[model samples]
Target: MQESQSLLATARSKLEKSLLAKGLRRSGERFAILEEVYSRNDHFDAEELFQAMHQRSYPVSRATVYNTLDVLVDCGLVRRHHFGEEDNSKSRYEKSLGRQQHAHLVCTVCHRVKEFCDPRLHLIQTNVGNALQFEVESHSLVFYGQCTDDACETKPTDSSANTEDSRKTQE
Candidate 1:
């Protein structure tokens, strides 16, 4: 999306091929939207993405954005989340599916977001599935805490209060 346009070409080819196989129209803007999302490092909501794309004159519509996102979800290319009831029907989208253990930290005070990766999630999923004899489909874990300007340290048996204090300084 940023450079040699080949990235866009490859992504478009894959998306179009996938969509065509399902007998769906490969409407023009969806590929652009997917390329933008895949090439970026930030999480986004529909309106946020639409505004940003419109500012860049990407020829995108809100409906197409949402539709493309649904397609991405179906294709296992993106994950969606509902952060709040007041989110105006816009869901947060993140980039990932496999080999990724993700957790989020939220500030109810300011609604700030933070993400982390933990490898132990796979083991947890496996154990949970084994315990229930139900195959683990997918899982999400989010931890909420009040974040202070200076340092806020809270751990969940996770007796890393001191370690957390050190990490907060980086923020």
Candidate 2:
């Protein structure tokens, strides 16, 4: 609990600094959105966040949510991900402060996202950068397939459905 509180304080301070630097208003609604975001561990879209704000009785507008998300992304307070081609219109976001760089495992059938970090991935990045004499600042790697969890949604068994799903996943 103490660690979580400390993290939130640091995040809040960063957001304040960013808002000031960008000449954006220091609104309580933005802070409330930050708090709501830091309170969650899942990857979520903007609509889900707006619903959560309303569920918590905050009642922020959809535009506010979207704009705040843009601010957060620009200020490095959040990380946005484009998981698949099928849902290119919807982007998922996660809090980035006090967190290490990680990769994602996405379930195509259930559309669930899981995060993982592998030291070897970092090593490989370093090795490839050295080999090609190129600077590797960062990377985004996602593995998409069916999840094994019992709660994961099952894929349609029909041949046409399978073909369509496979095509989407490959994109």
Candidate 3:
């Protein structure tokens, strides 16, 4: 918790500097959004962030949340990801403040994301970029499959049970 609070404070200071550099007036809504984003260590969507703020009576609009997210992403303070396919489509965002570049394992059925790192993968990325004569600024890699969590293992005894499990997973 102390580490996160430290990171959050650092993130806020950086955000203020970025806003100033971009010639944008600092706003409470932006700070509130930044606070929420910096507080969490997991990926979340705009609606999720907005809802969290609203639940805490932050008095921010959905549009503000979306727009602020765009600004954050533009300023390199956030990383946006489109992890799943059409039916399960959603754009998730995570703070870029104190994160190292890593890959993701996405559960297709449960939508659970796990981060992993491998030195070999980093070497491969560099080699591949060199072979293709392209400079690689960054990369997002996602491996998709069903999760091995216990909740995901239970076979549905009936259609209703399956629906309940699906709903829970989505939540």
The candidate that achieves the highest TM-score relative to the unseen native structure: 2
Q: What are the clashing pairs of model 1? A: none
lDDT of 1 by residue, 49-93 (tens): 888788778977788888888887777667887665356475788
Candidates' C-alpha lDDT: 0.73, 0.92, 0.87
lDDT of 3 by residue, 65-128 (tens): 9999998998888999998756556789999977887999988666777899988888989999
Residue pairs with backbone atoms closer than 3 Å in model 2 (clashes): none
Displacement of the residue 48 alpha carbon in candidate 1, Å: 0.8
Better of 1 and 3 by TM-score: 3
Every candidate's CA RMSD? 8.6, 4.5, 6.0
Cα misplacement distance, residue 73 of candidate 3 (Å): 0.4
Candidate that beats the other on lDDT, 1 or 3, i.e. the better one: 3
TM-score quality measure for candidate 2: 0.87
Q: Which pairs clash inside model 3?
A: none
